[model samples]
Target: MEDSPRSQELLSLEAIYPDAELDITSYSGTITISIHSADPVGISFAAVPNTQPLYDSINYLPPLKFFFQLPETYPDTPPTVALLSLWLPEATLTALHASLLLIWDDFRDMVVFLMVDHLQEQAFVLFGLDPPIALTEVQFEFFVSYNREQLQEEFDTQSFTCEICQQYKKGKSCLRIELCRHIFCKACLLEYFSTCITAGDIEKVHCPDYECTKRVAEERKRMADPKTFITSGTSTRDMILRVVFTPPLSLDFLSFLPPEIVTRFQTLFTRDQYEFFKSNFPNRAVNCPVEACGHGIIRDDVNDDLVVCPKCRYAFCIHCTNSWHGKSMCRLAVRLDIPEDVLEQYLSYPELSKDRRDLEDYYGKFKLRRAADAWHMDVLFKEMMANELMTACPSCGVVSAKMDGCNKMTCHLCKTPFCYLCGEFLDRARPYDHFNDPVSECYRRLFEGMLGTEEELMRPIAPGFAL
Candidate 1:
């Protein structure tokens, strides 16, 4: 026996939506139709007022599932149908359901295909609703996630030729950079990005496509210019905030890389940013002294030398690069490790003396030359005993000797205070705190080398004991 018209329609619907769930005996089925827009649709949240709508240029929206049952005399009678959607409101679904029924009234024969087509094409714009769809926050999130999943699903089924390998591959074996939308095979991208990161070429770790890289550079140039934002009516404050908050483009494609590579890329990227910052603002930027966390910190106040590293929460003086001192003077931190006698002896010999040449051969010629030049003027003025007692300021490199006071000696030239015993930089705010901290190597040794009738030096340098 030949199938009935309803059975024929069910078979046709099954053919049209291979993934749809259908009950052939009962003549009932559910077909999910994906809504695609020619132009990217805008999504906005009604909960977030006054903010710019998120314009991700989303081409796919959450799908609408059509649940329908064919009546016994389906061609003559309208089909019973309902629209269900996770993102769309109940009122919109109800309107869509009515629209589906109206289509059945107009084309009573084989209306499922026509209904599906109408929904696919007009769902975003139908029923007096247009683009920039305003939804609740939860709905908006669901829509975005659903759209991304659908897009990935579609992409995974398609075939594309990777520009790098010049070979056709399925989307599952490829990666599409989110910023530039340039596609490359996963193997090619992984190898290329891994090499760049391993070589510390962090700047070259972005999109490998030359055109995309150039376009990104141009975009960055445009963003850097204040006039670009001004011409577009964006406030300078907004432009600054955007530049400061926006992550680098290299970070956008990290999903394509392995976890270890991603970590290395992040570390290199941070170091690159720190170098760039230091180059641009030499005086204002200070390097954190913490060996493990050497992030660059930008100083807000020039007069106040205290700097707190944002990444490590380490509070140190900018001049001394040590723990923040409450009110004590900053101590000289210059390391005069090479003996002044050795440096003077090296300088005493003629430029071509065999003795100097021998010393230069033992030590690097450049090293001895630089050391001699650095201490030449200071050695000429101060005596040998005074030179041994003196410590140079870490900031200005000027030598200052301690005569009869505490270990904290301030440079006469640059006025930078330093510990005379160890030449460690002292914070101007609370210089004695360095000696008071139990973990410090110089703790309680502030007056260790001092002798004679200095009452302050004889005083105990302990916790809570004022010197």
Candidate 2:
């Protein structure tokens, strides 16, 4: 009926290790306590190389958890303790367990706190690390998944002043992006990115850590210590390294970006890569005035002033990015049509926005035009093959004209073997079997129409055709 001394100590542990998680239960007269380590670890071996993406993995090793069975008489009686987590070596665990008992004997009455501290200090040695680095993405995902609800509750209790809206929002409503630690309310980030994407401007994407960037120069000035030397005879000294605190938000973390924004940006990036190559090519393709529809046009002669963006359906003057003004020196300037609310929000962010007040998408428009041009050119090249006049190799995209031959063919550029008729990549070693094999869709079709006799010459080579 009355609480035991071991039970009272277990409750006191909750206060000692605030970050640590614990599970306690009583069965009959015995008490079992489970301790979950706040930290996780990963080991690299000499023979087995650590694979890529071990860094910043959301999935990695689980917490270094273990259980202890406290007898009716624990500190006074030297109770038994057990180790969990197979990641640790058996011998190391045994040694650690023995050491824990030795530690208990030092303070026979008060021992749990000392035992936990001992475990924490020796954790790195057991895991083969000196000072432990925070667990990266490798194991973060599993922990996050297992503790999502609890994490959200904890975050919701804290309040952050959103950088964009300048309004204090609870943790559940606010978001911190993947690489960059820039924090913002979900409403502001989603709307801001959506507007930019719709206008086809992706280059404007950033962590909004403008103040931190400006502070770097000031910080460098403060960090400039006098160059010093202490020589026994004549000794050289390395540069004095001062602590350079990383900005809370990293530019690298885009996981903070809305999923829809990331998806749209990827689509635009691909299109831009094609456009950039097309205009830069030797043909000197002319670009359309429209940023989103950067169609490329080929001018026939010097008097070709009338240029049309075939993709955007806009006709414009060749010399300037304006409407076709009939050679009279066009004079209207481009205007950026942005929403009032969005413009007001950007006004507070002078660090992010310099003299560019009319549009936040100036950088993005240039990128979009280049991408549009490239996408258009690639589309044209692909259309030729789509018409069936020429066969495009599935692997290399090289258009080949099959003058007169069987379906089996190989690309001259990449040396990729493929089926000419079906347009499927073929095995180089057993290329001919695709047509003659009974299981193949092109079965019994080899030399079926090559000789114009509607007869497939059995196995072996068909007289006139090459293998």
Candidate number achieving the greatest lDDT relative to the actual structure: 1
Considering summed lDDT, which 10 consecutive residues are worst modelled in model 2?
A: 235-244
List TM-score per model, in order.
0.60, 0.40
Candidate models: Cα lDDT each: 0.71, 0.55
RMSD of 2: 27.5
In the range 22-51, model 1's lDDT, one tens digit per residue, is 998788898887678767887777555887
The list of candidate 1 runs beyond 4 A from truth reads: 46-55, 106-110, 124-128, 213-252, 290-293, 299-306, 317-467
Cα-lDDT of candidate 1:
0.71
TM-score of 1: 0.60
Question: What does candidate 2's lDDT look like per residue over 332-384, in tens digits?
Answer: 22232233444444444554444332222322322223334445565565675
Off by over 4 Å in 2: 14-61, 123-128, 131-158, 178-180, 208-263, 277-467
